[model samples]
Target chain A: MNFFFGIQNNLFSSKLEIPIFKNDGTFLEETILYKLKIQDLEWKIEIFDKSKKNNFFFHVNSSDVNNNDIFFIGRHENLKKFKSNKLIVLNEFTSLVPHGYHYRSNLRVNINKGGFSSYQSDYPYKMTPVKGSVVTSLASVTNFNADKNYIFFKNIYELPIQENFKIYIVDLKEKKIKTFFEAKTNYSNFFEIKKEYILPEMFLVSKNYVGIPIYISEKNGQISMEHTNPPTSNILNSDRIDIVKKFKRELNEIIN
Target chain B: MKSLIRKIINLDFSIQVRNTLNIIPKGIQKKVSNQSSTSDAFIWRTDNNFTTKFKFSDILKLYFKIKKSHVELHFYSKFNNLITIKKIYDLDFSNEVVISKNLLGGIEDYGVFYAYHIMDEKKSQNISVNNKCYTGFSKDKEFYSFVHGNTLVRTFDYYTNNQNELVQTSFIKNKNYLIQKFFYSSEKNELFFTNPASKSVKFDINGKNFKLKKGHSKLISINDNFVKIRSNCFYFRPIAFTYNEKYFDVYHC
Candidate 1:
């Protein structure tokens, strides 16, 4: 509702900061919640718009220099100089999962068994899904709290339609799901993850790590992943299957 | 390496980027409903200090919308009960901004993590800090209390009628533990945790060390009577100053 201008009004400014909150499903609300201006000819300190009521931001870590990076998804090896607000863009489609957020995309895109895509709304237009082989099946997109290094989605056709929900804790920075359980009333009054949301138990554990994800069927506390190759990342999940050996076995023809 | 000091005071146009720790990145902040409505306001708040006092609106809904990264909090309330309306993000009026501080090292290449702040209460009188708990006057008219474990315990206001007389020292228990001494100073407006980690904490106050419910933070943070405990990142202000949960008959008084 108010604007403050100064002598260097004509000088360059960082891309005006914009806020995008993921409300529910595929809806987003935009607001210019934060503003930055030169304070005493030096610090371009960032502050709230002052006029706004409440402020919202994605989860952040304490180690970063600015202490306020926005969440983004892009390709691998993106070591490009950030040319102002535009950040780095990727040609490939990326998918996103919420961390401190509740909404999960549950949307899927191109690629074979474990392929997915997440674009900034404008990119993916054929949402209705055109018929045939080009289209892949949709998988349940659950929420996550961190910007993962690499992500792959498998069309999990095995999950049943039931809401036997339980809270799962993933130490994203460490890249692992610490614990999963069926919440029972008074069973776990507090969710150690976010200091909010106390459920009196009545939830259950589902998966461990990147298993068949499809073979992911549960009975009580035990889970079975059948023949699916384990997920690969900076760290190894299972000792049974060697991802390197499997890769060498299948793509021996491509490796020089 | 551009010193964070340099960036804080943005100078020079030819500044090139170096290590991941130099850039001051800004993310999208959104405004939610005030204590009045459930409808979305959709505004952003940049500056944050870890703990987010939940405005009357359900900030939890927003937590689910982006539930990937690690987010934790410490809840503080003057009402002594979660459902009570005197909580910092008291549902009776106005919305509160939520702040997020990075606990890990992720935003080096990007900008640093950011969140919101809970303003220091203006009317909170007598925020005294002694060797014991910080004691302060309550806005609550009917009674006075201090928060220990997500619950409020009534605190007896100390009157200085017997200042010069010597009396035998007796031990009393306070929030989550026992105490051996009680020193409430109105001159400095401070309450001391006097030997908080002592086998028995006896701040001459009248209260027993009852076990905080499962959802409460184990550690007690009392600063000159303006008390706040840390859970994950959020601060949980005790509903009242005593563990006497008398107001909360349902949970455990």
Candidate 2:
């Protein structure tokens, strides 16, 4: 059955930025399970780590994958994907579904250690390969002090890229904005927000470049990682688009 | 003509009608708008060994910059009975409420909960008053694993000057299916299902038939590597909790 109720004219390439945490006793192993739909599917997987001077790229195909219809991207003998801690995998592929390309593919990230494990779905996608902005509410930040938290940012760009952008942390209470950290595009940047700054009504804003902001919290051996939805998702009615646009504009003004 | 035919085949008319009914200003048709309120429902767990906490913020105040806003949380038992209602006033930037067995008057194990953002009717005339918050589960005073609300279930229309009126949105049971895969291992893997429909929802998982009444929740352990749910509701996603001894994970699938 084919349903195209909300089909758009433009087609989007599926892209996901899966975070590779440091295996410091907490995160022992990381693996990405990508379900392949079409035969001979082609994908461009890039590993970006700050410690390394250059990024690594892997051109993968579904036919060469050994597992049945599932492509595991990390900690493999044949595919030595992880190079350093704090690396990210930029997985990009064309969607087989022409109408609802954005909602077709699913990628799952699993991090585990001896019987203890956690997994999350990497469902966030971008329309453009690069050059878009992200504005989302970080309201779901865990309040447990035992849980160490960090925000993982991933941006894609062309080769020979040398650009840095500022991430603004908006304080909803004080009505103030501060540059939480300076991040480089085309790489995986991980930083922790101080406990003082992790207050209510806090928002993460990116103006120039587009990327995904994932909240990672680890306590003891358990880890929870998930991405916050865009501000537009808070409303479900037809006025959501206009309401979200106004909200974004006001947020941009506060940041500026 | 061709596009219209395609839309008809896709059942676009039903969706459009639903969306249209959702946009009629609140308080205009008190009964209809109350039933269609955009509030989201979340699953909360409390056991002898585990407890749940819901973290939320004044989202309407953050976006609309309203002066006064309050959050009312309605807790229900596994049998779909109203356990209690807690209200948090004098809203701050962030807030959290712990739902231990003691807090629910020492109720049963698990249930469903949702929040209603109450603001001045004149101030919130044209804004959305629903806050989609996150729920965290902690075991034995250990770390809390958190996940956001999954779907829109129910709401109480404060703008209609009838706080006693509870709005329950009806879920459509169709021929759609939502499949979620899991990693089968020696440890325990359980899937929690909550029915958001007004009537009893009958669904099958891996050829096993199960039924959940309105506003009720059930947790069942699964030995299979994946679960395929065939139900009338299109967005019937379940919350998964995998455990190996003390360490565990929680997420929506």
DockQ of each candidate relative to the true complex: 0.01, 0.27
Candidate 2 lDDT tens digits, A165-225: 8788887556679556888754445677665656666778887777667666666656665
- Residue-wise C-alpha lDDT for candidate 2, range B36-151, written one tens digit per residue: 23455677787647888888767666666776767888888888899898989888767888888888997748888878777644552556545567778887555677777645
Model 1, position B126, has a per-residue lDDT of 24
Q: Could you say which candidate leads in lDDT?
A: 2
- Model 2 residue B215 CA deviation in Å: 0.9
- Model 1, A1-256: lDDT tens per residue? 1111111011111111111233211223333332222223221323344332223322121121120222232223332432232212322222233211221111111121221121111112121111111100001111112111111212111111111323343332233344543432101111222222111111112221111111121112111111111212111123213533443232222221
Off by over 4 Å in 1: A1-91, A95-199, A209-256, B8-25, B28-253
Which docking class does model 1 fall in?
incorrect
Best by DockQ: 2
Question: lDDT per prediction?
Answer: 0.20, 0.55
Question: What's each prediction's TM-score?
Answer: 0.16, 0.70
Model 2 clash pairs?
A132-A210, A200-B93, B173-B232, B174-B232
